[model samples]
Target chain A: GAGVSQSPRYKVAKRGQDVALRCDPISGHVSLFWYQQALGQGPEFLTYFQNEAQLDKSGLPSDRFFAERPEGSVSTLKIQRTQQEDSAVYLCASSPDRVVPISGNTIYFGEGSWLTVV
Target chain B: SQQGEEDPQALSIQEGENATMNCSYKTSINNLQWYRQNSGRGLVHLILIRSNEREKHSGRLRVTLDTSKKSSSLLITASRAADTASYFCATYFSGSARQLTFGSGTQLTVLP
Candidate 1:
């Protein structure tokens, strides 16, 4: 089965520009998550979606960050007025279900979209 | 805030030797998961240990969880040069969504 996949493997954007990153979760996956990882740092949660509903956006660093999953399978993370600090690798992960324990639900990750804000 | 914290930011070991990494979390969790990432790419899930389980094993990977101490340890026995990578411990909090809070990770270098 195909694992999670992200588009635009690399993106270079000038400061104050807007960029949108896309994610395609595995077929039938019910849970999707977005994370931001700085160089040599662990991934930080950005947002979560179950089906087509966005459940948690608390991890989003600022209001400029927004995400949506309208069709329940594909998601997009949009950054408005990107800043130099936004330079990092954006990771996407998906799991079968959220109710199941972590041991039972193995979250698959994508190669990630690397964003460079110059 | 990040829930998990891994000690010993970096480690260097000879091939065929064992490597141990530890993680500590501030809050209670239902399970602890270990993941490996190579070259800062996607993370690969290694093992998961439930709060009730003291130890679990998968191939060369061994994970142990101690709820009383809010800490966990991942041990790799007979590590090979290919095992060199960044290892992370993620905590799944109880009652919350299954989202994982990952630690900074420990970079391991296995020299052949």
Candidate 2:
């Protein structure tokens, strides 16, 4: 893909139900990131991956949230036992090369997976 | 926790007027980036200013960084209705550059 792609653009999950959002980053981009944005708020970092290595998962809100990029290209963010507070847009972004936003590398974001917990 | 906080929580102006938004951070950052998000849409990267750089310009956007003051400002020249959106400032920490930490954001409305 020419840019980052996210699947399940919108999802409605009942409380306690689980949901999975998928992300396909730009080809050959080694860094991927996930963010959660509530209504009228800025996106917050959820997690980050450097290729297949989950270098940082410190930003995950709780144990119920899990993310993985096994092959270093496609990633999935799974929210288990979803709660009402989990209602937010999950954004996937990717940048070229080894790190986040070095000098010249630009980070591109997907349209996001909107999750509505009802 | 969020590293930056953008201000003028909300602003409204005419299409031809200029709009400026400011941001302040609490830590040493490797770089700061500005992003704009439309309602219910994704964010678009606007501009970036490294810690060593004081300012940068792109199209109608101008970004200024003051590491010593831990602040930055984004100025939009000749705002348009299409420029009405929420702007956010994100920081990549010098010690932690794996991801970006975003701010609360500023909602700018440009009336045509």
Candidate 3:
């Protein structure tokens, strides 16, 4: 793919329903990240992946929030028993390497999946 | 929690004028990055300045980082109507898990 791709650009779920969002990062990118952005706010960190290893999950808001990057190329963020407070835009980003690049360091972002919990 | 805080929450400027946005952070950071968003969708990376580097330039965008003050500024020269969007400042900590903490952002409106 030319850039980071995300699935289900928009999703509306019931209060107790479970929803899953997917992300496809750039080819061979070593780092993947997930973030949640509320209305009129900047994106907040959710989780990070270094290849297939899940290095950080501290940013996950609750036990219902889970993310996985199985093959290191594609990732999924699942929310169980969605709440109205969970309504937000879920963003996925990718970087070329583990260490920040001094010359051309930049992270690519997906269009994001907007989730609405009714 | 967000580490960066941006000033001038909303900016309205005429096209061809310059726009400046400021950001401040609490902790030591490896680098600071600027990003732009249109229609509240994906973010586009604008420029990045390392902690050791004082200033950097990319096209019409100029970024300055002052580690001593723990603050940074982004300047857009000769802004156009197309430049009307939200701009954000993100900080990357050296020891943290590759997470980029972002500020609330500044909404810039370049009127034609």
TM-score of each: 0.96, 0.96, 0.96
DockQ of each: 0.66, 0.67, 0.60
Candidate 3 regions with alpha-carbon error over 4 angstroms: A101-104
- Over 4 Å off in model 1, which ranges? A101-104
Instruction: Give model 2's docking category.
Output: medium
Write the residue-wise lDDT of candidate 3 on B11-71 in tens digits.
9999999999999999888889999999757999998888889999999999999999999
Give the chain B TM-score for each candidate. Answer: 0.96, 0.97, 0.96
All candidates in order of DockQ, best leading: 2, 1, 3
* lDDT of candidate 1 over B1-112, digit per residue (tens): 6788998899999999999999999888888899999995799999888888999999998898899999999999999999999999987787567567899999999999
What lDDT would each prediction earn against the true structure?
0.91, 0.91, 0.91
Pairs clashing in candidate 3? none
For model 2, the superposed segments whose C-alpha errors exceed 4 Å read A100-104
TM-score of the second chain in candidate 1: 0.96
Q: Locate the minimum summed-lDDT window of 10 residues in model 1 chain A.
A: A97-106
Q: How much lDDT does candidate 2 score?
A: 0.91
> Chain A TM-score of each model, in the order shown?
0.95, 0.95, 0.95
**Two-chain complex of model 1, DockQ on C-alpha atoms against the true structure:** 0.66
Q: Write one digit per residue (lDDT tens) for candidate 2, span A1-118.
A: 6888999999999999989999999999988989999887788888988899988898899999999999999999999999999999999999887774456357899999999999
| Candidate 2: C-alpha RMSD after superposition | 1.3
